[model samples]
Target: MTATRPDPEIPAKLLAWYDKHARALPWRAMPGEPAPDPYRVWLSEIMLQQTTVAAVKPYFAAFTQRWPDVAALANASDEDVMAAWAGLGYYSRARNLVKAARFVAELGGFPETEEGLRALPGVGDYTAAAIAAIAFGRRAVVVDANVERVVARLFAIEEPLPGARKAIRAAADRITPDERSGDFAQAMMDLGSRICTPRAPRCDACPLAADCAARGHDPQRLPVKAPKKVKPVRRGRAFWIEREGCVWLVQRAPEGMLGGMRALPDDGWSAAGDGSGEPPLVGAWQEAGVVRHTFTHFVIGLSVRRYDGAPATVSGKGEWWPIDRLDEAGLPTLFAKAARLARAASERLL
Candidate 1:
């Protein structure tokens, strides 16, 4: 059961295990049931990318409830969509989701082939393959993080990640069953997530125990990963201007980091400062403290400053939202944490 000589029965044993034990998810159709709707499949795949299942479940349910179909999502405004996608991070995916949805709607439906799906705004290689296989029942090889681990161990490939990805994909293609490729892909994902985990794997319950290449050896160590580079830290300042029971909020520019989302106006995180040392409004400023948040590439510390001057002097396009209804402002987690800090400080005054 090596990479060059994988057991052909791998897919069958895994799929049989899946038929009886596949995790019941809101977006999946059972083993023998009809394939789920393409729109649902596409949406779920998009939401699940780089995100955990538990984190995505509530968001998926809310999005589907608000926009039931591709056409419905296509008709949504960017503001509403961006706001809905606030806490999901990877803000670009939400932006791309809108673009792809509208494209599918105008085209009248999702493309049924891997190549066709690739042409969509956000559908990359993995996403296109998954949608084609899972929704259209196309015999496409779908390899995600979970599948990568499973295949790496099944064939006992010791090549480190990124570099080993090519060999892993090749091995996966060899073992992929032409029939029920959709099921086979999902089965691999389930087996990887549930049985062949990254940490302590439950190999005793594994259906492919006898056929596993890394069975006698340390299976968890296969699919070695490259060392993670440390993320650099950046600092910025967020202005918290409270007027009566309301707080001022601004919409970020339509592109770049945290773009098109509501946020407490901030001096951009630059040494030269996009708006350094200057608060949005001229007022006596009191520093409330700092809130730290980490992004994919950098960590940020945003200093929250409370304005203690005249509110009438503030004139801008941004609105003074009632502090009580701040939840509906769709602030990203960074600013949300800042708001909480500001509220806690304000409560001390009373």
Candidate 2:
């Protein structure tokens, strides 16, 4: 199909709006300023995936302070990176970040094109397009969730997502200008986030209010979403073996859920098994309590079982982490929640 030309006024209007109200993000350069460093742009984009700007700020600061550059990040130990990323939830992104950093360091610099960026470990279509436009001054159509909403409302595309993505991209492509594509992209995101919000859009304050097609109708109803599938709940058990103010913690296998992170030994909860797996050692076990955690795919109820046997009986490939320093172990969120429950139950018995 022949692509329709973007409204000539859209780019000018958006760019003018961006010049005055662009967000002050660390990864973004001010309007009319030199583009941000590719490394910072890439790192922030990765952390921002499936996460919010508020949640990514402290983590971004910490990572940049420690790694500083792609080379430094490449040289960082896997355990250290994983530990630093403990509470961030998506463990695989942390793993892929290390891999991508190493790959980039080996190449001497980051790729300057969307295609090249996509070749990296975890960089996908949206990430590649964003980096290309924002860091390299390339004219690529960057359509993230925010851009999707804006484009959908601007064109009044009534198709639901996943299926409607093609039409949305075409519509976004029509609006993307040749010059300052990066600013245009960020502007769309800002407009969607601040003015063209999902629940209650501030159409009166929007620069494109006159051009928006959904303005006459319910804008939120555009970019319609498909029905969501029900998330399944799973059950499992965690062992709390305390000895001399230390707890036994094991490193998870490197190829599964929460892989390569230190965690409390459990009855293989991730594999959809009932909380009936054997304990690490023959001991008098008591039910401490349960910790509920939700994953992207499932909800888990982890039964925290305390070991009442002697500490000498606990033998495995795990380390005895000091109870006082448990936070340093970098356990994943689920395991961290379980540890909190175990600690609380222990305190109650005293």
Return the top candidate by lDDT. 2
- Summarize candidate 1's per-residue lDDT along 52-127 as a digit string, tens digits: 9999999999999999999999999988898899998878888999999999999999999999999987789899
Off by over 4 Å in 1: 1-3, 270-277, 308-310, 313-317
Reference-based TM-score of each model: 0.94, 0.95
Residue-level error in angstroms, candidate 2, position 346: 1.5
Reference-based lDDT, each prediction: 0.88, 0.90
Which candidate number maximizes TM-score? Answer: 2
Give the per-residue lDDT of model 2 (tens digit) for 263-341.
9999876645456667878868878888888777778888898864346646668888898988889998888888888
- The C-alpha RMSD of each candidate to the native structure, in angstroms, is 2.2, 1.8
